[model samples]
Target: MLLSLEGLEKRFGGVTAVSDLSMHVRRGSIHGLIGPNGAGKTTIINLLTGLYTADGGAITFDGTSLVGLAPPDIAALGIARTYQNVRLFKGMTALEQVVTGCWLRRGVSLWASFIGLAEARRAKKATEAHAMALLERVGMAGRAHELAETLSYGEQRRIELARALGSDPKLLLLDEPTAGMNASEASAIGHLIRELRGQGLTVLLVEHNMGLVTEFCDTCTVINFGRLLAEGDPHTCLSAPDVQEAYFGRRHDADRIQSLR
Candidate 1:
């Protein structure tokens, strides 16, 4: 597995966000994590990214134990993520935003840059060039110089993804990448995700778009109230009676949720 969570538990005071939950993502595949609102999906993402520490359990990535590591350390370990909400540096241009991510992987010392060394200048130039390439990869090259805050919602999403990709991650964790996109925009993001998988990048996708989940994910893990409820092929697992019950009130509402795909 590229990433693994076993016996994971997280509590916020009296509320248990995740409890004894476990799941795995295979290398070079898209794995979907889905559930209704307040199901602890975002909490799990927080735990994995080091924003929140696990109370009890283990998180392993590529054979390394991830518990207690700092967020920067986890990111340096080749794990990168996009937020459920678009997060970009307010004043920075699109290319500059992604360049920050490149710096995470290949940065010259601040002292060297401050001294105006030739080598530091060369490295800075190379990093900017690479960031531009990433922007192009996400179809944002044309908007590379635009301030991230000024872009439309969907456009900002593309920039966020490009920035994440700048880290050259072996595993990408996407938290609702298609959250506010229209159908065509969402489909474009899905295509980009598939392209990444084709290049051997593993992904753990947390999305509510059932159509994207059903069509893009290789495996699906369903959770309810922070507990694992179902796991298997996306279509079949989602079709299960219990899974339907958790999403809707009863069997009849199943069709309504199922229609999302």
Candidate 2:
């Protein structure tokens, strides 16, 4: 396993966000986490990335415990993520925003950066080159010099993905990557995620876009009210009665439900 959650739990006062949840992400596979609103999918990402301290249980990545570590500490361990809500440096150019992610792995010291040391300058140039490649990979190369805030919502999301890729992560956690995208844009992102997996990166996806999940994810886990409801291949898990009741519940469009079957 590349990542494993063991008996994880989290609560907020009287609300339980996630309870006794445990799962494993196979190395180099694309895994999906799906559920209805308030199902604690994002909460699991938070706990795994060190954004929230687990109230119980342990998260192990590559055999190391990840309890109580800070977010940056987790990033440094080769775990990178993009948010459900796009998080880009609004005032920064697209290149600059991605360079921030690349900085995580650069060995340059802060003092050296301030002093414009030769090695630091070289590292910055190398990082920028790598960031440019990632942006190009995601079809955002033309906007590399544009301000991050100026792009369309879908473009900004792509920039966020480019930035996460800049970190050279062993495991990528994506939260609702296609949250507000139209079908065309969502399809593009779905293709991009498949490409990423083909390149040998392990991905854990938290998304409500069943079309994308079923089309791209190698396996999926479903949660309801913060508890594990089902886990298996997307085709089997999504059709399970417990998942259909908790997620679909006759609320989805007929076409959507029919597609699942």
Candidate 3:
């Protein structure tokens, strides 16, 4: 496993968001983490990224414990994520937004940059080139100089993805990545994700789009009310009665599930 959570627990005041959840993500594979609304999917992403501390249990990445590490520390260990909602700097260009993501890895001191040192200039130029390449990878190179706030929602989503990739993560956690995209746009993003996996990146995707889940994920884990509900291939897991009930209702709302297909 590339990542594992054992007996994980989280709460907000008296409300339990996640409860005794245990799951594992295999290396270099696209794994789906899914459920209905408020299923604690985003909370798990927060916990993994060190935005929230785990109340109990353990989270291990590779062989190291992630407990108590700060967000930047966790990121330094090669874990990166895209937000559930698109997040981009208002005044920053698409290229600039992505450059910030790799700043920590630049190794050039602020003093050096401020002093206009030749070595710092070289590093800055190299970083910008690399950032441009990432923009190109996400099909946003032509818009590299455009302000992120001015782009379409789907375009902004692509920029956010490129920014996350700037960190060169070993594991990428995507939270509702295709939330506002049209079917065609979402399918394009799916193809990009598959390309990333082919290039040796691991992805843990939290999505409501069952079509993408069924088509792209090699395996999946379903949770309801923060507890594990089902686990296996997407088709089997989605067909389970309990999974259907959790997603729809006791009435089974089969039509709704079918519509996503």
Candidate 4:
């Protein structure tokens, strides 16, 4: 397993965001976390990335204990994620944003970065080359010099993916990576994610696109009301009685969620 969460739990005051959630992500595979709104999907991501501390249980990534670690520390442990909303430095070029991600691998000291040590200076140049390669990998090389703010929403999301890839993560978390994309754009993103898998990167996907989930994810864990509802092959999980009940009606409305298609 590249990632493991065992009996994890989180509470926001009186509201339980995630309760006793547990799952394992096989290395080099795409795992889907699917559910309706407020199912604690992103909360699990936050817990894995160390944005929020788990009240109980354990998170082990690549053989390292991740519970209670800081975000930067978790990131340095080779986990990278993109948000549901596009987040980029408006003033910085796409390449520059990715270069910042490369700093994780470069390991430049604060003093060296401030005083511009010879090694740090060398790393700056190397990072640019690495960043450009990442941009090329995501088919954004032509827009490398463009400000992230100037890009379209889908384009910006691609740049965000490139930025995440710059860190050379062993496991990647994508929160609704195609949230605002059209069908064509969503398909493109799906293809890009498959490309990453071909390159041996493990990915945890949280998207409502059922077509993509069934086709792209080898395994899925479904959640509803902060609890696990089903776990298995994507198609099987999606078809499970409890999962259907979670999304649709027990009275046979026949209004299947389009994402399931």
Q: In model 2, which regions exceed 4 Å deviation?
A: 250-261
- TM-score for all models, in order of appearance: 0.95, 0.94, 0.96, 0.95
Candidate models: Cα lDDT each:
0.92, 0.91, 0.93, 0.90
Q: Comparing candidate 2 with candidate 4, which one achieves the higher lDDT?
A: 2
Task: Report the Cα lDDT for residue 24, model 1.
Answer: 86
Note the clash tally of each candidate.
0, 0, 0, 1
Residue 185's lDDT within candidate 3 is: 90
Model 2 Cα lDDT, one tens digit per residue, 123-219: 9889999999999989999999999999999999999999999889999999999999998999999899989989989999999899899999999
Q: Model 2, residue 216: what's the lDDT? A: 91
| Overall local distance difference test of candidate 3 | 0.93
Stretches of candidate 1 exceeding 4 Å from the true structure? 255-261
For each candidate in turn, give its C-alpha RMSD to the true structure in angstroms.
1.8, 2.5, 1.8, 2.0
Top candidate on lDDT is 3
Residue lDDT tens for model 3, 1-261? 999999999999999999999999999999999999999999999999999999999999988899899999999988999998998988999999999988866888999999999989998998999999999999999999999999999999999999999889999999999998889999999999999999999999999999999999999999999999998899999999889888778744766766887
> Against the true structure, candidate 1 has what lDDT?
0.92
lDDT of model 1 at residue 80? 93
